[model samples]
Structure formats: structure tokens, C-alpha cells
Target: MATTTDKVLNRKIVEKARKMKSYAYASDDPEISDFSHPSVINIADTVQVGISTGGSSPAMARKIKIKTESFLKKNISSEDIYQIKLQKFARIEAKQVLSTQLDRKKFLYGVMNDKRVKGLLKEGKYKMAQGRVKKMLRKLT
Candidate 1:
């Protein structure tokens, strides 16, 4: 049962969201709105991982999200993000160069699974792999 205060708060939130040209639904369920918090943007700057409490507990979800974000921020680097973007571009170009899906997958698999590329990546030498991927793509085009 919602108390009088809860009802009032819900009304206020609905009004605010409406005035802001948005829609609002009242939910005490944690998982449904955990990422809607402003601090989520800060967390996303490093990495994004979803935590779900299945609408049972918000406190536990918040704690888990904090720990997960801290771990990701410590482990993930800007270079890793850059490498992901580079691979995305390479895949897009490969789609045009390689006619068949199998050929595209095989070419990308070989590029990514190359011993030199793996070694360079393990050594935190993303730029080396970036160069190699771009060069290979250039040769294909």
C-alpha cells in the first residue's frame, strides 16, 4: 500500500517529467531504472555493465554496480575502446571487400587471431595491430 507521501511524490515526479516533455512511470523496482540515474553517465565514461535485482532490491543493485564500475574503470583503458572502434570500422570495410559472409568472417578471424596481432595486443601495443588491420583493409580495397 502506498502512503500519502508516496502518492504525492509520484504525482510530483509525473508532473516534472510531463513538463520536461517526457513520460514517467512510477517503479520501486530497482533494475528498471538503475541506469536512469545521472551518475550512470560517469560510470559509462569508463565502461557499462548492467546489474539486475529483478525489482526486489535497489540497495544491492547499487552496491554491485559500484563495485563493477570500479573494477571496469581500473581494468579498461581508452586504447581498448579505440581498438574496438577500429575493429568496427575494419569489419564495415571488410563487408564491402569480401563478397561472401564466410569470406568476411574468415578474413577478420585470421586478422584478429594472428599470432603477431595477439602478441602485440597482449603487450598493450594496440597501435601496431591498428596499423596492420588498416593496411590489410587497404590492400583489400
Candidate 2:
């Protein structure tokens, strides 16, 4: 009763289902079709072992604590953690550079109008500005 296109599509779906079934269970297990139930248990066991082994470093622990505290304070989820880390680092670095009085007007103007400096800043090359700024600041001071 099916058309040629319908038959072809049905055949493709059957083949995909067969492949999925085969992949979901070991060759020796004929009764098991889904591994999700066992996979969850395995995941719990792995997490328990990892926690018991003290697998994290001090630096990693500190970073995690700081991230957790910041997330609690700001109501951020884990998905946004990397962006938060980058923003925090950038803010600290910018504050340090600004504290040094490295020609704020020139730097801002250059960043706004100069293609090369803007490109470098966009690429997060603050160190490149450090030496140049130091020299210019020395001249001004």
C-alpha cells in the first residue's frame, strides 16, 4: 500500500533502529536494549571514586571556590562560568594597568582610532601595551 518513497524511508528508519539497538547493548546480551539505567549507576560510582581520591589540586580548589562564591553572589549558572572568569581577569588586568597611569587619554584614543592598537587590544594583548605605556609614562613623569 506504500509508495516507492515511503518504502525507501521506512527501510532507512528500520536500518537506523537496528544499528541503534546493536550499539546500545553488548553482543552477548540479547535482552538489554537500553544502557541508560546502568550508565547512571556507573556515573555515580565514578563520581564517588573521584571525590574520595582527592583528585583536585589546590589551585583548582581555590578557583572552584571562587567561582562558586561568585556564582552564588551573581546567580550565574555553570554554563556562564568561562565568560565570568575571562571578564574577571580582564577587569583585574585593566585596573592594574590603569593604576600605573599609562596615558589613559592616549591609550583610549589609540584603542578607538588606531587599527593596530585596537586589533592588539581585541586580541587581549595587554602586555604589548605595557612596555609602550611604560616608556610613554616615563617621558611624561
Tell me, by lDDT, which candidate is best: 1
lDDT of model 2 at residue 5? 45
Please tell me which predicted candidate would have the highest TM-score against the true structure. 1
Predicted candidate 1 versus true structure: per-residue lDDT over 66-117, tens digit per residue: 8777787877765566455556766887887788888777778777666776
Off by over 4 Å in 1: 1-24, 29-47, 115-131, 138-141
Question: After best superposition, candidate 1 residue 101: deviation in angstroms?
Answer: 3.0
Give me the overall lDDT of model 2: 0.40
Steric clash pairs (candidate 1): none
TM-score of each: 0.57, 0.20
**Cand. 1 TM to true fold:** 0.57
Worst 10 residues of 2 by lDDT: 44-53
**After best superposition, candidate 1 residue 111: deviation in angstroms?**
3.2
Candidate 2 per-residue lDDT, tens place, 1-141, comes to 111345455445444667766434222222332321111111212221111113224345445555555445455433233333333444444454566545554544443354543454556665664444344435544
- Which pairs, if any, clash in model 2? none
